[model samples]
Target: MRFLSLAGWLTVVVATAAPPSVELQLQDEAKQLVVRVEGQPAMAYQFGDEFALPHFWPLRSPSEKLLTVQRPDPYPHHRSLWIADKVQMGDGPVVDFYHSWKNLRRPSKPADGFRHFIRHQRFSEMKTEGATALIEIELQWIVDDNRPLLDEHRKLRLVALGNGAYFFDLTWNLQPHEGDVKFLSDGVHYAWPYVRMHPQFSGEQGGVLTNDEGRRGQAGTNDQTARWIDYSNTVAGETEGLALFVYPDDTPPQWLTREYGTFGPRRAEKWSGTKFTLRAGESLHGRVGVFVHRGDAKSGRVAEHYRQYVEDKL
Candidate 1:
């Protein structure tokens, strides 16, 4: 069994060597995940993990404890969970559903049929060099249906920097998914207390889309493509991160952008305000980057990091 424990550094001392990835250990008292960046010297807690958005999204029932933090928000964004146990499967320990409240796809019961395991989830990632550290992570997911099972794959990656911040990166690429494309939802959430208290330093913005029904065959509503997301934050650390997307094949209306944070993001007349469709022999992909650094939202130095990521990928 695979278990993901507190994957973070202990002290807040920056390192003096090359950078390497590490894990963060959440300090309940501080109510913040401590990070140690190797190259960044002027920033502590330069980047933080998922600051939960409480009021908007449900604490996800039994999935609360497994989550890191939860606050309230207006609409769209809702809540976020730093998923370390759910998808890890046999990599560490089995999910507890309570204290270790993990979110995963339980075997299908005869009566229920199938459903989406959880909406969108965020996870933490840390990289360090001696005392220095970098904190980064990525949160993503897609609707998983239980109709004969076609094909699917999703991955989350994080990079810790030199100061005491983090950068979490996630990649979600779904292929040959079987089923009718539906609507999508996306919005914003306030980490309520933390964000409300430090509004000038950190927050988030989101966007999503769904597909149509008529086009729900092997060539659903949209086609293959991607986009760019620059993270300008109100926090410490000047070097932020870069994110993008890539869809190699399919149709249009570019369905699948999440506009709301709900169990449903499809083309139905229910919660979501969108719809989409897809079929076999199709592929879709996206990339997003979050740069962790020191400063306010207006002066956040994320452009430089975006350039760095572009060059590194090339």
Candidate 2:
């Protein structure tokens, strides 16, 4: 009989073990939704009023390593994962919802430029079954003493994909509570979904970024178009990262990736000096995918994942 080393036996056991199970725990009073994989805390959804919008922070990979930085300095607006933008109601002046949280202290701003807040109205749905968890919420975008501008419905589904990976599908719908609203941006950045990776995963720290279009790094990737982009780095002696995917069914959102470890989609340049409307009584929809895995782009099978996403195989 052949005798295997202890380490070898352990490795085999780990490899052959059943995939990790995922559990989502909702802490309503704490205003957080926690996701656990194989009994290890994996991520959290934050919907508290501490920020201007709802976001996910402290995202982690299968290695239990944090993959996102929560409210980094100099850019506290850069949440782990969020959506917001400068917007206007009908012909009204632009309201800086994206960065308005900074102006919370200055209570005397003009009504036209008043800071806005996204208040979590309620959790419409929260359920966990098998290897997936689903969350849905309703939010009110308000300004100037509870003046509502928009109503948003956000839904997220997290699935355990095994192999040190998890997948999340997100859908957001916005409707003008008053009248038509426009999402506008003056610069190269706009209101959209984004992620801020942990400093350990910054491109300056030996991390790698790749897009479906074959572009590498933030130098030539920012504001570029791609179906998806992957940002990978090593942590705790293991390689892992996150990838953002833009579903073909939704509007083609441009990449707002960075080398310092931020990834997002922007409509600013796409709507520079112009704006699109979320008509009254009509909802504008946005869909996206987030993949957390344990490897670099190729090693993580990024393309295969994208194909699965577009083909609805996931």
Candidate 3:
């Protein structure tokens, strides 16, 4: 007689399970989002056992626009990619995300070091206790390191987005705000269709973010004390991509300088721009949400959808 134990039968099925065809993402209204960008592929998030920063380190040079640079083995960005089940794949499009100084070719002071300059070399293991995927990031930062940057810790939660959009709930134990943190989108506009700040239309109308107190005719307090800004191009049907930042403790900061397609201090060579500092032993945190959509940031319909997202308290 031929018989099979239930456990053995289950193991057989598991071993023969089909490989994942495409990556997946969605939104979780429950948790506050820390990071979420539209249209990122699974290949973009590969790492070793823990999340490792690949050597590439999504970079942009002076002669060229923003692009992925492949240094030799120990590729920087490759180390950053999260590891899957050893699935080989081709390199995907370049998506620039700066959680540390690595993202910038030249940040403020380039040598003086950044505000509260946190030294982050490792990512906590991806742990799943209940229904959420949790990952904590440790940084080697020095408070009193700069006038505006105070040291702090950061935590991010990757929740399942049954749909095609991902919800990254990031909590920042921030280093105080050194210089103002915003975007320099002149050349960058070529890549991302929509880009804008919160309390402002997404990037569709081409509206830029400036610390123009004069424009605050009737706006609320800059709310510098830990608030968020969201940008997205949408995932499900069609929408706008998002760019937003929040500062807890209302960390004081200065405005950023402009570059062709880049945003940071000392773009060319002459340290030109405001320089804020984060005192030692201080902490701050914020959240950012990105949604890749199929439309512009200011379309009438898109505006309504954005309102819905805000109304839903996302």
- On lDDT, the leading prediction is 2
Candidate 1 local lDDT, 96-136, one digit each (tens): 21111122334343234223232223334444444334444
Question: Over 4 Å off in model 2, which ranges?
Answer: 1-16, 91-93, 107-115, 250-252, 267-273
lDDT of model number 3: 0.29
**Candidates sorted by lDDT, descending order?**
2, 3, 1
Tens-digit per-residue lDDT, 13-44, candidate 3: 23342321222222233211122222233212
Against the true structure, whose TM-score is highest?
A: 2
Instruction: Please identify model 1 stretches exceeding 4 Å from their true place.
Output: 1-21, 24-71, 75-77, 81-116, 119-152, 176-275, 297-300
**1 versus 2: better TM-score goes to:** 2
lDDT of each: 0.29, 0.79, 0.29
What does the lDDT read for residue 57 in candidate 3?
Answer: 24
Candidate 2's residue-wise lDDT over 1-314, tens digit each? Answer: 23346755542223356755788888878888898867778889887766667788878887888789877865877788887777788666568777765446464643333356787899899888878889898988887648889999999988888865889899898889978888776456653576888888879788888988789999878877778889898877899989988888645667777788877775423353366777788876777889999889998898899889889877
**Candidate 1 at 40: error in angstroms?**
14
Q: Measured by TM-score, how close is model 2 to the native structure?
A: 0.87
